[model samples]
Target: MTAPLTDDEVGKTVVDAEGKELGIVAKVNGSRAYVDPNPSLTEQFMASLGWEGDDEEDYIVTEDMLESVGEEIVLRGEI
Candidate 1:
């Protein structure tokens, strides 16, 4: 398993294996990252897309799905 994402991951660009920009990390909680597919939203709205919400619109990326992390977060496979 991959290591958990840190708080710094928030706002980092997220991409797929092919390097397609999927979204931005809206929030980080332990091993999970709440991704905002629509990056144009305000920071306040982005932060609301959390695990505690019942909304299915929010996307989640786990540590195991990560391919690499640097200036951006790349997933092992396309979401």
Candidate 2:
């Protein structure tokens, strides 16, 4: 497994393997990273496109989902 990103990586941009922008690191606590998810044009737009799982839930960027850490956080899988 890959090593987790540090809590200090907050505010860094996060991207998926396909290089799709996920969001920015909001807070990192233990094994989870709270992300200020990428903006959706509107609530309806998010629902219409189904950007991801659940929009209401808080996003946590865990180590398991992480691929690497650099100027920005790189996620493990494709978008």
Candidate 3:
């Protein structure tokens, strides 16, 4: 089974299976990672250890959609 995502994922870049840049991980709650498509420096900094953000534009990526996690986080399919 695949391992769950952690708060360490915050700030990491997220991409689709085709390598299309989707966004950056802003927060991680349990197995879900919140992606901020256009985050400011302050928003990025405030995403410490899974603290939730108030941005309505942010989207959620669940563990089932995760493909891999390395230099960047890659999703199994398009967003």
Candidate 4:
């Protein structure tokens, strides 16, 4: 089991295995979070922080993907 992360330690840079910028942590909703990946990537992004439809609509990223948590937001390798 992993220790719980705090809100203060959230918003950190999420880099890939090769140290590539993915995105910044937006917010944590439930068991997942909203990772706004870099615009350069072709992946779609959420317009805001909330639910939309059948899909979570918030770019639901799991905590396991988290690479590091900072004073601002959480960081994940990829989502």
lDDT of 2 by residue, 1-79 (tens): 6666655666667788888887766556778776667643453244234332333544877787878888778888742
**Which parts of model 2 are misplaced by more than 4 Å?**
39-57
Q: Candidate 1: TM-score? A: 0.75
The residue-by-residue lDDT of candidate 4 on 1-79, one tens digit each, is 2235433223434455466666644555555655555421223232232222223333545667665544333344354
lDDT against the true structure, per candidate, is: 0.74, 0.65, 0.82, 0.45
What is the lDDT for 49 in model 3?
43
Question: What clash pairs does model 2 have?
Answer: none
- Would you estimate the TM-scores of all the predictions? 0.75, 0.66, 0.81, 0.45
lDDT of 3 by residue, 45-66 (tens): 7764445574789999999898
lDDT measured at residue 4 in model 1 versus the true structure, 0 to 100? 69
**Which residue pairs collide, candidate 3?**
none
**Clashes found in each candidate (C-alpha, N, C closer than 3 A):** 0, 0, 0, 6
Give candidate 1's total backbone clashes: 0
Worst 10 residues of 3 by lDDT: 46-55
